[model samples]
Target chain A: MPFVSIRLAGTATKDQKSAIVADVTQSLVTRLGKNPAAVQIVIEEVSPENYGAGGQLLADRDAPKPQEDAHAESSQ
Target chain B: MPFVSIRLAGTATKDQKSAIVADVTQSLVTRLGKNPAAVQIVIEEVSPENYGAGGQLLADRDAPKPQEDAHAESSQ
Candidate 1:
């Protein structure tokens, strides 16, 4: 069974999660022979304000969104 | 965004899957204050052949053990 579960928002590097469980258990033990202790890799890490993208967060995705019609035509 | 990925062997009832999405999403929204749509629940179903536990396939999980001193001999 290919049990590769990697949920990420932060915190990787225990050699980048053992190189993603040794490159997905050596690609399922060299193209599906399997049985490297049945290959179970689970990594779940989170906390960039609980994670988001495009819709923002990750510290407001590098800030700078104050257009507001160029400050309302420079305060009229 | 709590994306709950469910990879199970064979198919589950469609209602079953949507239930998983709803349950986890609602749990996130209700408890953790998350956006419902941002909770991506990915379902990846596999065939019995590609899945194994206790060094055996799903087809084999239900069948009788030939006195191999069963570890978790029931979960169908």
Candidate 2:
């Protein structure tokens, strides 16, 4: 049996969660030959303030304008 | 940064959760030298019916009398 835990930065719609569960279950079944009924998936939505990466809180990182991706691509 | 996700079979009290967070944070800080401020811990309490081990649901397994542990010990 495999228990999968997914942590997201924010809340997800019911439909989105359902899709994720289905996709994760299918992947485990296909790759590991695990029983679909035995697969468990728990999705945890944490506030941005509680989630951090690279020593910066997600809330602070997201607060800035969404220009970093474009700036990086342009520089490349 | 270390993100710790704990999956429990059922709900935990706020105090219990706080203790767990503190313990986990301390462990990471001591062992990995991670910053306490950068550590994120999410506790996911899932229903027994959703968790399975050895192809049996935790709900069903827990429904039986808790004598199995004693029986195994006695046998040993």
Candidates in order have lDDT scores of 0.63, 0.78
lDDT score of model 2?
A: 0.78
- TM-score for the first chain in candidate 2 comes to 0.79
**Tens digit of lDDT per residue, candidate 2, span A23-61?**
787888889999887787666678999999989999998
* Clashes found in each candidate (C-alpha, N, C closer than 3 A): 0, 0
- Listing candidates in order, what is each one's chain A TM-score? 0.32, 0.79
TM-score per candidate, chains pooled? 0.50, 0.48
Task: Give residue A53's lDDT in candidate 1 (0 to 100).
Answer: 82
* Regions of candidate 2 where Cα sits further than 4 Å from its true position: A64-76, B1-43, B47-76
lDDT of 1 at B32: 45
Misplaced by over 4 Å in model 1 are: A1-43, A47-52, A55-57, A60-76, B63-76
CA error at residue A11 for candidate 2, angstroms? 1.2
